[model samples]
Target: MADPDGNVARAVKLETATISDALDRLGIVGQCYGIKGRDPDFRMAGRAFTMRCGPNSTPPGTVGDYIDDVPEGAVVVIDNHGRTDATIWGDILTEIAHRRRLAGTVIDGVSRDVHLCRTLGYPIFSLDHWMRTGKDRVQVEEMNCVVAIGGARVGPGDILVGDPDGVIVIPHEHEEAVLAAAEEIEAAEDSIRAAVRGGMRLDEARRQFKYHSLQTRKDAE
Candidate 1:
């Protein structure tokens, strides 16, 4: 029997592409589309703390009011309905999140004060950055619930792995299998490269490593 061993959070070198491949083999739709890193150089991995937002009510509402309650080392995942016109995050949140050692943040919509994030090296991934605020436009509807990011559904505590390529969620229930598959895929890919370096033809090296089927379903393998 397998269980999520917690190493995925510590394996900073695991690429989103490899994990995505693992998800594919496992038949899980964990790949996030459209949402991307605020800075291509930024990479992060952590369990999620999700927030969902909706249009403000007649009385108006606030954005990012629940940030203070988030615990350390959790990636703050926000769902803003994919709206790109307004922003839900900014410098103050970034400063605080950084000081608290939070893992990072990901938004289905836009974020503001990106300069601060870049300066602080605080990882943030979103549709884009804008100057307009969402204070009166969007309101937090819930916390730690299932939320959508780039068409992918993320629940509280799902493992979020992100990098220059993009973000991929590892559903909590499948993390162990996904991590095992990803590690295997990475090893096979590495072996192919090492074989080539030893003077083997690239095609021969790939054949030796069974590279094409590295991510094939285990049942089929």
Candidate 2:
């Protein structure tokens, strides 16, 4: 895969808002809408291990069996078609993932027993939470494949950065460019803040840093 260590290390330090701005500047659609952390304190950054689920088959397939194969520092991304009625993740998976040192879990659907995740400090992001199980309701249809979560396309190994605000996906191919752009955006914002603190007018600080055009696509300019 990509240089997981270097990229993940860089990504973890950035806020999702900055990355989203960079993506916008690059004309990339990456914001994962409608997905937020179970707890506002939850945060994570790592490569994606994608999973997709659908209605159970004739004999029914399994859910969460692929957890064992996930590598450390990888984020488990489950796409359940935004089904809030059934839960495909629960406390047991949370405990295991925590113990296994996985970065976190993001579900397009809801997860049950959310208290355990909070107690363990294992970051879990989803649309919502419900208690009903998906044992025979939904089955894993694919693993390590391209999946859609929160209205964004997530391919296997895509970088996922999440914070209190939300999550954003960065395709591997755009990783380097996105990181560079995000860092630049962050630096400019930091400068603006410092200027404001130093008694400069807010409008003047923003103008000096070109904050208004920071997220404008280059080609569109």
Candidate 3:
């Protein structure tokens, strides 16, 4: 098993594409769908701190009021059942999350005040950006629990890597294997690129690196 902290550190150095390939090779489903970073330059990697939001109740529970409680460097992942009619994140949360040095925020729902997130260079990934607030429409029902984001299952402490491409979630129990596989995939792809740069034909380079099979599952091999 990889050291808990070390897995996060290592994952931070990898790209989601590589990690996604690794997950494929290991037969793990981690690639998220339809979620994207607010800014193309945004990138974030960290352990997840998940929250699940549901329809508001009487008096309407507060939304995103637990920002302060999230540990520094952890990604705040909110599962709002992919709601786009209302936003569960906004400027205030972006400001506080930036100041607190959170790794980033990921929402299965929409977010408002995207300008603040871009201005602060804070990473925010979501289904989309909308101005409608979720205050009366949604409320946090659980925290640090298993939640789904972009069709991927995310749980407390799961590794989340997000970039311009999107996000991928690695279960805590499989962090070590996932990280190792990602590293290998990345290295092989790097070599393939380098080979092509050094006068080798693309197909030959890919063949040499066995690029086509890099993401094939171990059991399949």
Candidate 4:
């Protein structure tokens, strides 16, 4: 679980299989805050490579520099302090990220290049979209630092799960435990679903499985 690379690969695989399931299992809460006209169905699953920026940071060597340094298959998470004046991601950055095989990006700011991202099918979750660059509004203060995305605290190596629904962060320290809990949750849900199909009442299914108590006791046994 401490191995960032392995955790990312596993997260990606799980995401590819079950985006909604993962979100349900992780108990994520955030709407899909993305620019219109882009890939609205964008979903990304990978380890987070966080960036925290403040006003007055330089360009071409600030956030972009750290972006270039992020390993392949990462999910770049940018916390621009909720700045909306300039765009943090754009067409060219999307291209580079795709080339690097990065999973996607989550920005607490604006992004650009809607058409290109749509065509490329790259996932980018952000506050807004714009044509202006983040030249004067933002600068990368730290790379791989803890940042907030949609009010969720995320750190480097944490699992980032994004989809049409929203984005969720699973802290690195709880990766394995969360995954295991998710699997158990899924299994119990499956049984409940089956019972429903077999003419069991919804409340009956919940009562039998003790669904409300499932998560609380997941780590106990």
- For all candidates, the clash counts are 0, 0, 0, 0
Clashing pairs in 1: none
Residue-level lDDT of model 4, residues 1-221, one tens digit each, is: 23435665555544322433444445643223442224668877778888888877334445576657878878888988777878888888989998888888888888987888888888888887888987666677888788888677788887887765566677777777666666666678789999999999999999998777664532343
TM-score of 3: 0.96
- Across 1-221, the per-residue lDDT of candidate 3 in tens digits comes to 13356888898899999999999999988988999999999999888989999999998898977998998889999999999999999999999999998999999989999899999999999999999888888999999899999899999989899988899999989988999999999999999989999999999999999999999999999
Candidate 4, residue 126: Cα displacement in angstroms equals: 1.3
Scored by Cα lDDT, where does model 1 land? 0.87
Ranking by lDDT: 2, 3, 1, 4
Instruction: Please give each candidate's TM-score.
Output: 0.94, 0.97, 0.96, 0.80
Q: Which regions in candidate 1 have their CA more than 4 angstroms from the true location? A: 1-4, 219-221
Clashing pairs in 3: none
Clashing pairs in 4: none
- Worst lDDT 10-window in candidate 3: 1-10
lDDT of each: 0.87, 0.93, 0.91, 0.71
Cα RMSD for candidates in order: 2.7, 1.3, 1.9, 4.3
Q: Quick one: best TM-score, which candidate?
A: 2
